[model samples]
Target chain A: MSPFLRATLTIAAKDLRSEFRTKEAFNASLSFSVVILVLFSFAFDPTSEQMQAISGGLLWLVFSFASALSLNRSFARELQNDCLDALVSAPIPVAAIFLGKALANYFLLILVEITALAVFALFYDTHFAAQLWPILLVIALGTWGMTVIGTTFSALTVNLRMREVMLPTLVYPMLVPALMAAMTLTTDLMNGIPLGGDNLLWLRVLTGFDFIYTLLAMVFIDIVVVG
Target chain B: MRDRIMYVLATLSAALLTWNLYKIFMILPDEKNQGAIYRIVYMHVPSIFTGFTGFFVALAASALYLITKDLKYDAFAAAVTEVSLAFASIVLATGMIWGRIIWGIWWAWDARLTTMLVCWLIYFGYVMLRRAIDEPTQRARLSAVVSVFGCVDIMIVYKSIEWWRTQHPAPVLSVRDGGGMGPGMESPIYWNWLAFMCLASILVMVRMRQESISREIDSLRRMAHAY
Candidate 1:
């Protein structure tokens, strides 16, 4: 492997190991998802058909909020012992560090999204077992888009006094396009519609968003992470 | 000498806008279908375009700031963003008024309108991000990253929202589409667009001057404290 890839992997592995030891972000995000799910159920109290109509929006809403929470923690960890400064001072390229942290966030958020999906299925009394692949595809692509922007902004606001407040303000608006695509795709998949025409357009949008934001974040992260 | 140029440009833009307003209210024949309601389009379309132009300038200045590490570009970015926010507000307010009259509602999730609001939100985030950071160079660097991201994200938003609007149909005014305006209406629209762009240019220069003066004072204060 190239040195950059190796450095990226090492940083990702380090985050994964540290997260496994404490599960702080994981635990916080999961519980936040549960709370959001419960609140949504109370707010809507939808009948089964109504649930079917709106569950896609509700599911993505929960994940977007939870992703913000976890991404904030992921970067906050770096600030704990001036570890970010130490990492920056090291020989690793800054892009590698960005990819590493974003990769770890991607994995963590995906796991939380899966858990949210299961809980949503149970609460809304809906089943997605048949449309599993398409649903997962939407979730993965959407989560990656969210993580890329979220991770970058989390680092951007890491040193701020109001960072926790700042992260979501920056991340949420940026993620709106991708989340809208994911929601629409989820709704269509639930309706058992094949991907064509409008559905394909949305899928293309989600893919394009993922590609552009990842590339932009990679290019911009060095500016943000370094002095 | 530069001040005289700005004064001349400002006076010219003012004269052009006054003339355009007269043409909109009196000279242009009202649309057969909507009558006077179509008049707001003169302000609405131009505001949106000028706001977009301001954002594009900020995006370019931000990129230059990052590349050159020059504070001048940062000042330019900040100035353009502040002016753009004013233009964006005008766009939203006029849009809401037009919607009320045309669509019989205060607001609807019309794709263009929704995307414009999101654009405003993203720039609002950009402004807040700068205020939250205190260090000069770091603030410049991070805000530049956001300005670039904002520029790219708006295009994605325009695409995604356009597709979403098609799938979920809503009552659109269709004023700009099939109901083609004659030269009488089109002339005022273009003229006002030019006026708004000129006004936007003058405001950006004024704001840029203010930003640099404030920055100079900050550095001078630091120098005095060192003595």
Candidate 2:
């Protein structure tokens, strides 16, 4: 592997390894998702038809918040022992640090999302057996879009005092379009609606947003991370 | 001299606002479907245009700051961004009021409004990000990156919302290209747009001066410490 890829993967692996050891972020996010899911279920009874109609929205909400929760830890880990400063002074490319974090957050969010989806399905009594593939496609695109911006903002806010509040404020707005597209696709799939021209347009938007933002974030991350 | 220009611009803004209000209330014709209440467009649409201008300039300033590493560009970006948010608030307030009067609802998930709200949140996030950090240089650098992304995000929000509106039909009114405005309404829109632009520009200039002064203070403090 090239040096850039090796550096990126090394950072990602380090994060993943540490994450597995403590599981602090993953556990916090999963429980946070559960609480939000449960709270939402209470607000709107699951037995109602309205609940079914908005299940896609509810699921995405959980995913978005959960992802935020996980991403807040992306830089918190580096802040320990002044590791981020060390990494910055090291020979590793800045883009590699960003890509590695994005990748790590992406994987972590997918785990949280999958868990949340299962719980959402159970709570809402909605089945996605037939629509699983399309749902996964939406999740992948949506999560990638979210992680790209979220990880970058996470890094940006690491030095701040109210990082917990800062992360969602920054990430959530950019994630709206992705969330809308993902929610719409998931809803249509759940309703057994085919991917018509209209649906495909949203899919195109999701894909386009993911591609554009990830590239933009990669190019700009060095600026955010470095002085 | 700089203060004198601001005074002149302030006077111009006041005169233009008074004239635009007169034109909107007395001269402009009512919409065929919605009477009287449609006049809110004079406020809402012009503010939206000005906000767009503010945001676009912010994007350019941000890019320039990043490239040139000049505090002036950073100050300009921050100043205009705040001005843009102020205009965005006007858009939202006017839009909600109009929606309430015409559609019998204060809020609707219409595409244009949703996109505006998203854009507002992103810039609000930018401001929060600025407040969170203590280091002036780092804050400016990260903020520039965010402003650039914000500009790009607004475009995506526009396109996504436009597409989303197709699936869920929204009230469409366009003053541009003679699509919605009729007769006397056209000229007032032009004048109001120009007026709002003047007002927004003046606000940006005043705010930019404040930012520059603050930056100078910070640098002066650092120099004092060095002594």
- lDDT of candidate 2 at residue B184, scale 0 to 100: 58
Best by DockQ: 2
Give stretches of model 1 more than 4 Å off.
B157-162, B166-179
Model 2, range A111-185, lDDT digits (tens) per residue? Answer: 988988888888778878887888888899999998998888888888888888888888888888888888988
Worst 10 residues of 2 chain A by lDDT: A188-197
For each of the candidates, give the backbone clash count.
0, 0
Cα lDDT of candidate 2 equals: 0.84
lDDT of 1 at B163: 62
TM-scores, one per candidate: 0.95, 0.93
Question: Among all windows of ten consecutive residues in candidate 2 chain B, which has the lowest summed lDDT?
Answer: B167-176
Question: What tens-digit string does per-residue lDDT give for candidate 1 at B1-227?
Answer: 76987898889899998998887887778888888987888887788778888898899999899889998889889989989899999988987887788778888886666777788899999999889989889999999999999998677655654566543223233454544665557667678889888888888888878787887899899999999
Q: After superposition, how far is residue B182 of candidate 1 from its true place, in Å?
A: 1.4
